[model samples]
Target: MLPSPFAFERPSTIAGAVRAVGKSGDGMFYSGGTELLLALKLRVIHTDRLIDIKGINGLDRIALNDANDIELGARCTHNKIANDPVIRAHVPALSSLCANVANIRIRSVGTIGGNLCFGEPHADPLTMLAALDARLVLIGPSGTRVVHADDFIRSELETVREPDELLTVIAFSRPTGPVTYRRFKHGERPSVNVAMAWSLGPSGRTIRSARVRVGALGSRPQPLKAIEDVLQGISVAEVRPAIEAVLPTALGELEVNEDRHGGAEYKRHLAGVLLLRNADEAIAAAGSA
Candidate 1:
């Protein structure tokens, strides 16, 4: 079905875009329309106006900040991120994930900000960003605020972003150690995905901290706190064993949805498998480092 007629406005500034969307109360900021266009055509979402923010400068840049954080402009496409030298050097796992999101067409046109704003449970970037402890920068008429990635998505197809707010940047401290991601999928979207980041001690032989996020099994990416706790302060050689002891408990803590992906138990099991795989990759990376 074709979408209902709507007005389109191309704004040259973030403030202008925010004002345009806020004025209509039913307007949306448009960049890469991969998800929005499809939903509009199917009548799942209807907007009175689309405030094009592409012309707003600096929304598509990828750079490393002075603080050593990787800042990805909200309008950046998956292909752009996957091939960016800064992204590849600092967060290669994220680069690989973006390179394979959906296909070449979607990667070439789907903006990361749109993907996160869509808040799809089965999506990829949200999970990886959560593990990286990324910060999402939202700009609105009232003011600007930064939200941690885990808090950005409220539930399935829903985020904390107000209609009037614009997501301008995604920033994360460059990983201090190995970063790994693994996923299982039967179609375009993943069934279960895991992202793990470790902060190795100065000696590079012990874990100072760890972050584990399991995605696609719940409304939002969830942290495996139990596994992370066990991995902390442990030597590299003990990493796998430590995780093995707590893996089942951590997987059980996840809120799995038995949807088209698979049975709840099956998806939960896949999360464990992927987490272990990520651990192995991290272990190898540490060994070689």
Candidate 2:
């Protein structure tokens, strides 16, 4: 497969990148071309020009921002995040997710921003990001604004971002307790992924709160709000039975669609399995603490 002819550009500044993409939507912001180029090759998407944002300074940095949030530059590749000490220390689950994304080749070259922008339902990041309650900062010619991770993707291969806006960073607060992500891989991508995060009380035995999200079974990662509600304040020891009680109904709420991955019922079942596994990890963390 071959991509159609397109003009290439490397913009050194964010404003320059935004200007290059313009209001008419003929151009696209390209960093790691892992997703964009493949889509182009498959003729799933088209663009007359690609504005590369990798050259823009500071867009590749990963650090804690002034807002007390961990800010990951949109261009930070999966390998960078996976290998970073800060990410491993503050958000080990995220680091592990990044480390296990696709294969070594993809991890070496794919950017988290590209992964989110591609909006592939079977991908891993969205579930974890949603569980983390992350926020994405989009920069545009007009101005900049924040979008919740939950609201960023409208559907598969679709986002609320304007054509002229470029995603600059992903930010989230430090987890107050055990944070965990788990996924079932069918091949290079996940068939269904689950992410569970907790906020624990002083002794870490009581769950202050939890966020649960399931992906690869819907248009985008959908929150298991029902399951989350059940997890709040539950003892670490009781997480299993408590979550299992509501698991069926909670999985039923996700808009599961059968595809090459598997049937709706099987995938939904895997979602429950993954979530429980994550909860088990959380329990171990609490016990060790």
The TM-score values for the models, in the order shown, are: 0.99, 0.97
Position 202, candidate 1: lDDT: 98
lDDT of model number 1: 0.93
lDDT of 2: 0.90
lDDT of 2 by residue, 128-179 (tens): 9999999999999789999999998898889998889999999999888999
Stretches of candidate 2 above 4 Å error? none
- Highest-scoring model, TM-score: 1
Clashing pairs in 1: none
Q: Which candidate is the best by lDDT?
A: 1
lDDT of each: 0.93, 0.90
* Model 2: how far residue 102 lies from native, Å: 0.9
